[model samples]
Target: MVSKSSPHKSALKEKEGISQPESIGKNSVAQIIQFRKQQPSAQELIDGILKGDKISLSRAITLVESTQPKHLEKANEIIQACLPYSNNSVRIGITGVPGVGKSTFIEAFGRFLTAFGKKVAVLAVDPSSTISHGSILGDKTRMEELVKDENAYIRPSASGETLGGVARKTRETIILCEACGFDTIIIETVGVGQSETAVHSMVDFFLLLKISGAGDELQGIKRGIMEMADAIVINKADGDNIKKARMAKTEFNRALHLFPPKSSGWQPKVTTCSAITHDGIAEIWEMISEYLILTKDNGYFSERRKDQNQHWLLETINEQLKNHFFEHPEIKNLLEENKKAVHDNEISPFAAASILLEKYFR
Candidate 1:
């Protein structure tokens, strides 16, 4: 009661002082204003990315990942310009169950490639939190050695509810990485599950990592994932696990033989590697090189990429159509009501959906 009026007046005066333009330095005020007015140009971004500028490549990727309308338009322009310079890199997709030592294997594998004067780009897709829509996993902290390598570029993207544990813009990010002179692109999916098919669709070579002593050797992995692999490597083939790893490798080789011959006609091979000891890493790479040579010599390499591009075109169209339908303001408004009606047995789900679709179409 004694000092309430004085403190109240003082707080009001302080807020007024803080809100005044003169409270900030002239240069600082101008910089803030300038930031709001500035936007990156697609041509400048394309030029810098093609020149192997990491900063530009990062910014361009952020642009493509943005869902804002203005940024989406610019992102498309940048991609269109980067397309001709893209697809120069060999894209490989890697997956495995949790605790399969994927981070360790990739770190060792990436270092091996850089040691040979190769530029490698690793794009890790982290699982997204359904509630917050933010990445739940942090991949960068796991790949310590690879993160320190000068010739390696690693970008971890949030999966954001995408079915494959891959970001919607990951394929576009690969093109940008290729334009930056990365000869090899490695896309690591969330884990060895529903996301494998998504990664397999985009990569030229699909590598599945497995660890020994997981019950039935191929215990948790789906049969479809086995058929998709070009190569299967059993990790942790060191210390006491070496014997188990070898047996697992032989088991996988037999399992792969049961499947029909792959379209490329290059039989899948099984090998064992120790990420901790860095053994058998080179042999795995040599195997990949042989597969590349065989596919390229037979013209199947380019043909596969062509088919992937066509697949992506149709996939994108489907995604856009769904986005349009769900994001429509009218549909969004009616959705809950129709859902409630169906839940209450007031209307059949099909009839409710049909009513909504009619409203949407008109």
Candidate 2:
């Protein structure tokens, strides 16, 4: 049906044809895969951290958080090398109940510090998810400005199996931050509770953030966290809430009198500020500055650090022992059986636990 010339040339082929894009090169794919598998040496990480490199600091923290024995061993070497350069910064612990503007206040506070040329590092311990076993708020996403600031570094870690508000490796992480030339280290807890106790042990200053409420509620708690706080900062003190915040501050001040005098000889202070409006932020810093001057003059600062080191020594031992007992293969199998027996009341809960402990010992 076609002429010989038409069959070879065809008018349809004379029109413009669509062009296909080039395919991905195999070499590029191999290079990307190779980059993913590459890990920097511990000494390289240490050098980069000392030179104020954020990328290296982040990689080292990830190494510390890893569960692998090799990663842990590398993390230990990094920590040991960095230890000599740490403990030079002021460690501040910030804790509050949910919806109390902990993140907002911390952002404002951190911005204030960074504005004055202080390198700030915020360690935010996020609540762990029950289903995924991961962090609920990873990477300090709530503090947008602070997260973007060059002088401010924020690292969010999952609470994991650590019972307190902070992570198990948080103490070690602090050493790295200080080594990276951060003058102010801020730790934000998941929420205000038993976690406050854990944070109190590690920090030079413990600031409890609270929203304006009825004066009666402030006075309801006579001791506990109220005693541990070096300062109770009433946040959201703008416009309509200013009057109420003043009332709460006065109430908190009166309640603070009930606790015994601190060994540091510095009295607790109550102050109010607005994280939104950035009001009264400087005064809060001034109060903390005064505290530092007082504590340092009396030598309580160094003494307290010594005490914290001893406390951590014992805590690390307890943590390791508990992990060892719970992680053993034999213990894991026996624990499940004991749990079933205890549930069905075939054996008393205490006896079942004793048998498991005995087996673990055996």
Candidate 3:
């Protein structure tokens, strides 16, 4: 079926010195140039996001998370524009010790929400290697069902330069997701010390996913985290594990009752569920709805958000001040010089730090 001078035939016969059209190469180069020249403006990104464009939403989050100084102004502009449309979504923080089925639970819970006509966004934080500063970033691969769903958005961010398995820019990413019409935003944290506190500060509800017979009942979860949890879910409560899960649930409930009353006046609940079997998922969501209603009715919801905003303002100031001190060229030089002196016992650690601080201030 080959024509005498078909382009496909010519391409196949290319080694014979048949001249293919140079237009193809020229056009590709032109397209590349055009793409580079046409980065979307802030308003354009905002418009695309408002129209529920997922690609634009991803780009906006990338912009916010960018470390390049050149992108700062544009990122700020995009955030300011999106701010008017944001803060309407319910933000949930999910955390669990390793092997606790956090991904499975999220897949089940997210799909459940999306089935009822809600758009869900999952911001999963992956821990980066301390040496290489690289992350597996495979959360999407783990949540196969939710990853395939059209109503769901799963963004896995590297927990670089931030401890506790959360990206430094997660709070900003939440705003971008909310502005893009995602009704539910789930924040997954690295289940390490101090990470729960960070996640608790930014979410409407914090849920701790636990499994039964995981050695110790507390399983390294700090007491402060127990005090902050809005709900504790005992996952993997199916097959032969049902009895242990139920016992774990009972124990958790009893322990929760001993904690001081929450400021919201709503008692935290503990329940058992199987993410694989999809059992008791609905009950957990119903509890979430009830908590939302109660908190909203008591006017605690708004107050909590206001308090979070205030907390972030101070947190931002502290982070920026630290970054400025470290990034300063003179301070960097002084630090290296003084750190060596301290290592060799030429100067005390306190004196070295004081010298660096004086140099930073001056």
> Judged by TM-score, which candidate is best?
3
The C-alpha TM-scores of every prediction are: 0.88, 0.89, 0.90
**Which regions of candidate 1 are displaced past 4 Å?**
1-38, 218-221
Q: How accurate is candidate 3 locally (lDDT)?
A: 0.89
Candidate 2: Cα lDDT at 111 = 97
Model 3 C-alpha RMSD vs. true structure (Å) is 6.6
**lDDT comparing candidate 1 with the true structure:** 0.87
The sequence of per-residue lDDT tens digits that candidate 3 reaches over residues 55-130 is: 8998888888887766767888888898889999999999988899999999999999999899999999888888
Which of 1 and 2 is ahead in lDDT?
A: 2
**lDDT, ranked from best to worst:** 3, 2, 1
Q: How does residue 84 of candidate 1 score in lDDT?
A: 90
The runs of at least 3 residues in candidate 2 whose Cα sits more than 4 Å from the true structure, single-residue gaps closed, are 1-30, 214-222
What is each predicted model's overall lDDT from 0 to 1? 0.87, 0.88, 0.89
Per-residue lDDT of model 2, residues 133-189, tens digit only: 876664477899999999999998888867764645888889999999999999998
Q: Which candidate achieves the best lDDT against the true structure?
A: 3
What TM-score does candidate 2 get on C-alpha atoms? 0.89
Model 3 CA lDDT for position 227: 90
